[model samples]
Target: MTSLPQQTDKKLGLVIDLDICVGCHACVVSCKEWNTGGYGAALSDQDPYGDHVSGSWLNRVHSYEAGEGANARVVHFPKSCLHCDDAPCVTVCPTGASYKRSEDGIVLVNEDRCIGCGLCAWACPYGAREMDVAEGVMKKCTLCVDRIYNDNIPEEDRVPACVRSCPANARHFGDLADPGSEVSLMVLARGGFDLMPEQGTKPVNKYLPPRERPAEPSSCGKRSASERESTADATGFFRWLDQALERMG
Candidate 1:
């Protein structure tokens, strides 16, 4: 089995805002493109236009409607490998194929060393690991490790493809280990929470909850036309996501 690093020099990860995600799947597409292009393409599509269409992708989003009637709101939740501090997938690997990097705490799979074993997928609680049926190797988000460190790319484009391509700016990338980092401050201010924290994985990525909504209006009184318009404008997801993120401070 593989062993995890006792400590990493930097904990690089994502901070996602649930309030502004538009469920556009831009991150998903960008992740697929970058991972499959020049950066050691590992993804595969099983019958692109057939009945059972499936593809190996690192990022995905799920949407859910919370509450009902006037209190209801659609929340777009994005999911990916959280690169946990105590990554069970790494420890569960029979070979040393899966390991968490000591430099950045990024959990990654060395495809050459991998034996196409599904142990890592079973060990991951987040359902982040995907088995590439075509190649029989495990695939998951690597935090765009290649793009992040490449000097050839423009400095502003150093972030993960998903982060760079997000239209809503709902995704953020930085060193979460630094107390003063923008990502860390955002977490502190927004009360970012880990996904399935009880599992003890200590996921590096954090999610900000949807902002609190106004109190439900009384059924007895109908909303005035201007009041209704204001409410509708406020709740429009894509319309004001940029403004909201800016005001998020």
Candidate 2:
């Protein structure tokens, strides 16, 4: 078993907003595209065109139905390695392949040191780790370590690929240890939560709960039929005028 760092300088992690995630899978696709060739081993797709198709992906979106009847809503959950403070995946690695960095608390695997024993995957309760069938090694998200710290890329773009590519801007990345950081402040304001608190992993990543649905108006705010029609007419005229202006410009 490998020993984890007693303390890390920075608890770098992600904060996902459940309120605005549209389940577009943009983050998922972007993560796979960047990480497959960015760092570690290439993500392998087995029998891609066949019926038994499978591939190693670091990020995945899961859809769930919550509430009932009028309150029913489909929630899209994006999941990945939580980079737990007490990471079981790191401790269970017999060959010391899986390790969490003391500098940023990012969990990573050394492919050369990994024996493909699958112990790390089993140890991870969140099912974040996956085995690349072709490469015969366990693979997981590295938080885009290569891109985040790379001086070759622009300073403004120094974030995980998923965070950069998220169309809904639901994903956030920053130092969680800093309470003044944007990510930390958002977590505090939105009542962010962990995946499995009972497991005692103390995951660094936080998830913002879905915002409460606004109460529906009983009678459309008591708008008269003629007033509604007039509003619609004005809206249409403005929309048409805006399009004409764009074309002329």
Candidate 3:
């Protein structure tokens, strides 16, 4: 039986897989291509070749190292607007342009009403919002609303540009409100975590946890049992303790 459209509101959103993301920055490029040229506003880059290079991106990939010193690990986090249920960004906007939709959990900026005060950017702890210098207005991900709703685009290609362009397939778009939805299932199965959950953004977007690699065993491989030491001149204290413990056991 065909499911009624109203039965599940298409509250499309993104799920980021930290485990599989290679930090290739493909999604960043695709976003730049679509958004820098598309309807909202141009994502401005201050200087293409200058020493100080800064720009607006609806999406940004951040690389981090976990643990300390030699045992440290790398983590690639792709940051974007969470489109939160309790969005501080929306409420802080003095002009009332930024708002959360009841139809879908998407937080959107009404470009017509935005006054470009940039208070929303300051309000956002995730640094998801940006000001388009060229347009002199704030800009953020629209979740490809224009493309998703357009009749001309193929249904398969109607997803947000970031999800469509992800080389690692780390980004997924769907309704999180529906328990049966693919995004919902994936989040449940993976135990995905919210960034800075204490902030209480109630972000619609979820990030899959980083997969843990097996720890390498310590390199103290020498032992008296394995190798005969004629005089024990070179043996360390741990080796002597190991020999004593082995005999005691």
Off by over 4 Å in 1: 218-249
lDDT digits (tens) for residues 131-216 of candidate 1 = 88888889999999998999999999999999999999999999999999999999999999999989999999999999997677
- All candidates in order of lDDT, best leading: 2, 1, 3
* Span of 10 residues, lowest total lDDT, candidate 3: 1-10
The per-model lDDT (C-alpha) reads: 0.90, 0.92, 0.81
RMSDs, each prediction? 10.2, 8.0, 8.1
Cα RMSD (Å) between model 2 and the true structure? 8.0
lDDT of 2 by residue, 129-238 (tens): 99999999999999999989999999978999999999999999999999999999999999999999999999999999999978754434456777645533345779
Per-model TM values vs. the true structure:
0.86, 0.86, 0.81
Backbone clash pairs for candidate 1 read: none
Alpha-carbon shift of residue 80 in model 2 (angstroms): 0.6
The residue ranges of model 2 lying beyond 4 angstroms of the native Cα positions read 216-249
Model 2 C-alpha lDDT versus the unseen true structure: 0.92
